[model samples]
Target chain A: MRHLLPRARRGPAFRAAALALALAAVPAAAQEGFGFGEPEAEAAAALPSAGPASGASVGGELSFSIDAFYRAEDEVADLPFEGLAEGVLEFKASGTKVEAFIKLKLSENILGESPEDMLDEAYLRLYLGPHSLEGGLLKLVWGKADSQGPLDVLNPFDLRDLRITETLERKIAEPMLHATFALGDFTKLELAFLPGFEGHRIAAEGPWAPAQVEALELLGIDFEGYLPDTEGLEYAQAGLRFTTSSGPVDWGLQYFYGRLPTPAVVFIPPVSLSLSYDPYHQLGLDAAAVFAGFNLRAEAAANLTEDLEGDDPEVYNPSLLWSLGFDRDLFGGINLNLQGSGSFRLAEEGVGEVAYDIEADTERTRTRVTAILSQKLRNETIEWELRALYGIEDADFYLLPRLAFDVGDAEIEIGAGIFGGDEEGELGQFAESSWARLLLSYEF
Target chain B: MKRLALLAAVLAAGAASLGAQGALGAEEIVRASRDRIQADTVSSRSRMMIVAKDGSATERLVDQYSLDAKEGKRTVIVFQKPASVAGTRFLTVSNPGRDDDRWIFLPSLAKVRRIAGSEGSGSFVGTDFSYDDISSSDREVEEDTHAILREEKLEGKDCWVIESRPKDPSFQYTRMVHWIEKGSCIALKAELYDKKGLLKLLEFSQFKEVQGRITPMATKLSNLQANTSTSIAVEILKYDEKIPAGVFTPRYLETGRPQ
Candidate 1:
């Protein structure tokens, strides 16, 4: 874990104060109270008693948004780590029959690497009588989980340039065809077909791959790039999701037959390693219900892969995952969400793999608890959010807190991320990755 | 025509038989108010201002398309705003005997999400209006028992003050009161009382005749306890507008047009 852990970027309180000052620089309107939601759009009018009838509108809406942010880090291990700058520009438009969206992200290291440009999403959608068909690059999300769910599988996420925390938006969109049909008033059926597969843009080679790779190397586990010859059309993917709501409850049943997002690194003795994404079938169920001002959601999935018996230590076994969560608003404009999730491996006992002890084989059942508390003020123009992820079984946790102020179309905020726990725990392994940042963005 | 004639006959006989004592039932008053402005289709755009107790105000722009369906009314609302809420759309289909079906498309999610029944009590995008509040205007007239409380003069016009109590004990509002213009039968004011007492007051004004149709162009909902208020000002309104047939479906929520 130590060798694979990404070194943390730390900074002094002075840097944090500087970021805070920058955040407070925005001028606020002289008003007493605030609320949240779409502030730009408004409605009201005095209708004409009688006048010429207005013609139907066949045109659409068009808008462009620009967002940029900078963050300063704290000192880590007596060394100064430069911060980062990020920028994104998006163009969107949707008519009665068509929809289009495109976005580009630019990332740069304050003291290091050059700016890198990424094409985030470029997609178009069409509405066809009770059915919707979308093609081009698409980001598809499934499941009703508050946080990440084992069932919310579709887009393989690439790490955010500034991966300070985890969010569902980390998804990487790829070319695919998505169709949704309304079975009736209360039900919907969705289908997705992928001509090709897109695996996670996870770590591969050298120094930038995080220090943890060295430990794996010490254990004779070496990782290689994707097999160039395996990029054939046979490796496609498809998925189906059926959703319905009755009374107070909403639920969805989904199925997907595709290769896993993360590849399993095959270990064949010293100085040898290769990567392969094992094909698997997954069955998922998700539901959400609101009661007493609280929204409760649950998601569960059973995966079938190569190693059902679990005896083959090298090949990962089938897995089972479940998540339960709730969201509610409390006094003082505060919203709180909490979730408990667990993952289990389905493997037969005594199925014999002697290379490593069962305890250290990395096949143990894991559980975690996560929470998000957010408060809004001045009508929702100013919001402060705190998120925490705790590994229940490993006793490790990570905390991220931020303050954001929305000035019309622009926003500014500064905050720090904290990580602590057992070195063996998931988040604890990145204890040193704690960093503080300031963000600013504008939409037009 | 038959229903109106029957209603007129009933009113005339009641006026004679119970001259001093009001004979108008709660259901009749409500039905009259609900049907005062009748059209096959309705389309309008308006500006809304939400004011906080401290006097701060925010504005929103929206367009609404309402079509009369066999079961009830189907309405689609699209936010045309400063930008934050732009491209957001909401569709609600009325169900006569049961609850309505509602769906929303948030620009942020880029997908349509079905709103569950439990969410009906929640606020409508941070506004004073709740999901239930918006649909309550078309709520089944029979769901509650209505009775005319008194006949009084309001603003120099004869008016019927009515009270209604829901058949369901667990309804959000314990009781409701309405001030309906006697001749026009248009509800000019309403008050909702919850368990804690007086909750809200909704007022309709800016009465105008559109193509022989009487329409209230403005509405203000005030939250008594919260000291917050929201007012809707209709900017462009037209009756019997030829709205695209597809506007009533969920596809219209996401694509802005129906197939």
Candidate 2:
């Protein structure tokens, strides 16, 4: 069980690509989370007599977006130009809901490698009272906020580069069951469970494997020839959130816990890969407040996990990780956001330190800072935003600038970004890269 | 008719002395109340409880509001209850000296229906209070002639009692007596009368301070004839945020979502 961690970490690109396809195929008609529009007093007027009975109400919204980018690299690795497109459809009836999503990668011209092109993300949802059942391929949201940390099920997209990160691409959707209950005026409780099954499970030797060894080549990560077959996995999560208002102060707090399965295979001599499953635990908290022209939001999460072997080891010990961030409005529509997070390995034999020497029990921390300026045109429908991010651990900086224009029923936007960092294998060699893209979306 | 003459004589005497001292004079009090009502338009989240004649009750969360004088044309946006009218956006535009123009955006039907002014006197959203009661933000000062009644203490708060008679016979209420807070100039209570001089509805509640402005944050309006009442509590008050002008447009109401 412990030996499969390296392999699981190797193949992120394939996973990311697959997740993207799935997201695109998702229908736009799915029920969005909570939303409230401005309220007005009812007119002091009488209504006319009732009309003929109409059938039950039904409606939905759809969105489609595509990203294209080109990169100039010294050695031109596997891919330099990539194109991605995604579409979503959502519908609701009798308060019941259904959604479908699809994601596709049209072309990738890199260092000359053409993989089997494909489709991703197909699922459906049904709501019965307090319970919602989901099937096919689906992304599950867990925790109070920031599903990215340890329980993220969806791939994270990089709009400027038209690419999704390799690290986050491996999250896949399986059949799941979810439920929500109103705790009170200011609070709600939700729970979800997912059971692992055959067709959904990735086999160690199948042509379409969960984690492909070849995909990890770019990251310089390699796993020993041992291929582990996973039997199944199970996940459960719960969250509670509450909101309250007193005078000008409005605020809320949320807490969540998720336990997710991590499947791996280990091949012993003369025997095919044997599947073993380990689960990871995640806990998170989120809080927000709005007053005057100011808004504040903050979130944090911690991941807990144990090595597959019950006994403690020394070299590559597992660790608990946490992340936190805050955002505030400066003036007009301008806002400032700052975030920092780090991971620390708990002291254990044969696990805590390997490649780098460390104190028997020590914590490693990474931090990042970002600043953004946003402005809303007084009488116009256009808005603009500029942002910059600096990563402390990697000593890298990224700049993102975007402009959005409202055009009747749709919104059109253009954006550009640049990233500068130290080159790989070289201590002080610096490098820089940039990309740009455009997007159009409509809501009904 | 003779009783009306006697009441008029008494009001004249009260006005003459009150005007001479200029201390909370009848005219001054009425002017202050009108000015306060016109100062700011408020958007509030209200929980409305409707009690029926049989003592049964229904509760709903209503997003109700009015734009301040600065907002120019009077506008109101009412959100429908989650169960019956979820996604319903209703808008009413009031024109001076004329009946307000009304439209209801039904999300279920995806259509905007204009409401005739004749229907304005009907109960609002199944509550005992008429829609007129809800949109009376700009009730003209001259529409009702005010006569300072007296100084009194009600519900542990000091108030000014004043009688107001509708200048227009078409107005639903014949006369209304208001309890106004001397400091905030907000009407803390009101008693409505029918054309026959019979008590009709009673409204009373103190103004709660929200975002530096004093407003009637909670109100209890009772219908004497129907033996029913509605109590509304407004929470989470925010002022002057960048709300899209489209949010107030008729198109937005019908869609239930802003563009």
Candidate 3:
């Protein structure tokens, strides 16, 4: 589902035409598959705080980082060059039945004089008897899927990001109050209340926007604006999750009552020219287990949107989405991960009735597969990885081979990506957008 | 085993008798070494340094917590540093008859995944020590056949050299030889061998007394075949310390805080 932009809330200070972008790079990229190599202790240990000589724990850590990258890609692919300097201050206090944590981020862009994003996360957590309460901003990750999963629905993704340049950890945190009650030894019941909501960040115009727009034209619909706001507490998004572990298997059942993070167009045309985060309900089941040598994981979600019957093409439609994957070590140091994910329209009405060739549309999903193979070498100081994402039905694919070296307190990464197959397919749209990039980051 | 015990008493009183040492069977000596360092809980923060053949080194900060349970010992290791390995946690719970239940939590994926087998023989987080090496003390004596090699004096301390061969063919090491200090019963050194021959050399030093318990502050593992080694020095250590039991679960893996 996709939607239109609401009356523009973006101020003139957005520097919309700046030739540079505010890089959203997250340091979590190099920390793949449990991570390798060693880190210095002097600069890494959490800030010291004296406990009862032994009882209650209270301490905090402050860290600063500088990141710079040089890219050789075309104008529409993304910003040509970007650099950011940021500092993270985190404080943690744990005592009795209470454990609190908060992180404040301060950043400034080297190129773009645009505004800097601040206040990364702040949360206060209390443990009362068998229940827990947490409130403030948080990046809550869910589901068992490896890289991507339709069942991982709690947080909204940063759509303005460029791959490799920004890690998936760039996901925006939501203002939420979450609670969990222990039901048994390996089970817990979770409830969350999200007060503020935002739809997916859709880039106004870029090389990637063409295919999406073209697909709409084929459906005899005109793309317009997008609206991302929802009312306060009374209409707040809410969710419930039941999680349990049995022997070697871990599983969870989830239910969410909220607006779809993505949008459905207001194809009811005459009245409004905007897109919105339509109301929806979802039921999801996810599980993970390691048998033989493979670490198996799977997730499935069935969503009920505004157009449950699929009679309206302009509204969001009901759909079933799922993902299955496994990870295992091969040879001595090579690690392999493979995943298969897919989504299906619940009914054949409306746009589902329109038949377009594989190359004509990228959003028309049937099946997609992703694979990641990484090898640790040079006494685990050097890492080499090859990642692939393919649209099986559309015959479109993207490949990226990257290398990273651990030098002192910093990591140097270099990589190149290539896109091929049907030009209208998701990955294939970047067929001519291929480019190489170099990134250097140091933490202290 | 009785004859060996008698001989061991004889050696303790007067000499170095290899034949008498054999009388005490390897299993009894191993049991003493394993049970000597008794404690309800253990907590420590260590700095690990890995040195390659070229003398280049990489360092890591690690915190380990272990508690003795009814079944066996439960251990957890967390890496906090360099941004690359930060927020990574590995948990291993020992079982009486089974190998172990192992799991790892990586912040990147933000999930706790199981490590299928202890026999995989892969290095523990790129270190020279194998995954099983971290829990070798918890391995049951019945899982292997033991025999005393001899009594030797090295580093000016009397030592009983015992050899243990795994009864299960699928085990990672074919055989292992340990140097158990005569009176203290602490393993000062160990040699591991596979089908190809000697694989690793482990040495423990910097013994210190904490909470009335003798603890080793330094340990080094040398990968003989690769000419690489890793040394871990405990910066802070506490024995019989109180650690919340909740830290053993995945919840602590994400929060780094014990309930």
Select the stronger candidate by DockQ from 1 and 3.
Answer: 3
Per-prediction DockQ = 0.14, 0.03, 0.28
> Using TM-score as the measure, which candidate wins?
3
- Cα RMSD to native, each candidate? 10.3, 18.2, 8.4
A15: Cα error in model 3, Å: 20
Candidate 3, residues A42-116, lDDT tens digits: the string is 332222321221112212233332222223453444545444455554544444555545554445531233232
Q: Which residue pairs does candidate 3 place in steric collision?
A: A4-A225, A4-A226, A4-A275, A5-A225, A5-A226, A6-A226, A39-B59, B4-B23, B4-B24
Using TM-score as the yardstick, the better of models 1 and 3 is 3
TM-score order, best first, reads 3, 1, 2
The model with the greatest lDDT is 3
- Per residue, candidate 2 scores C-alpha lDDT tens digits across B10-127 of 1111111122324666657766665543224344456777666667666667664445333245354555453334566666554455434455555433334343332334445555
Candidate 2 chain B: 10-residue stretch with minimal lDDT = B1-10
> Which 10-residue window of candidate 1 chain A scores lowest in summed lDDT?
A29-38
Indicate the docking level reached by candidate 2: incorrect
Provide interface RMSD per model, one decimal.
Answer: 7.4, 19.7, 6.0
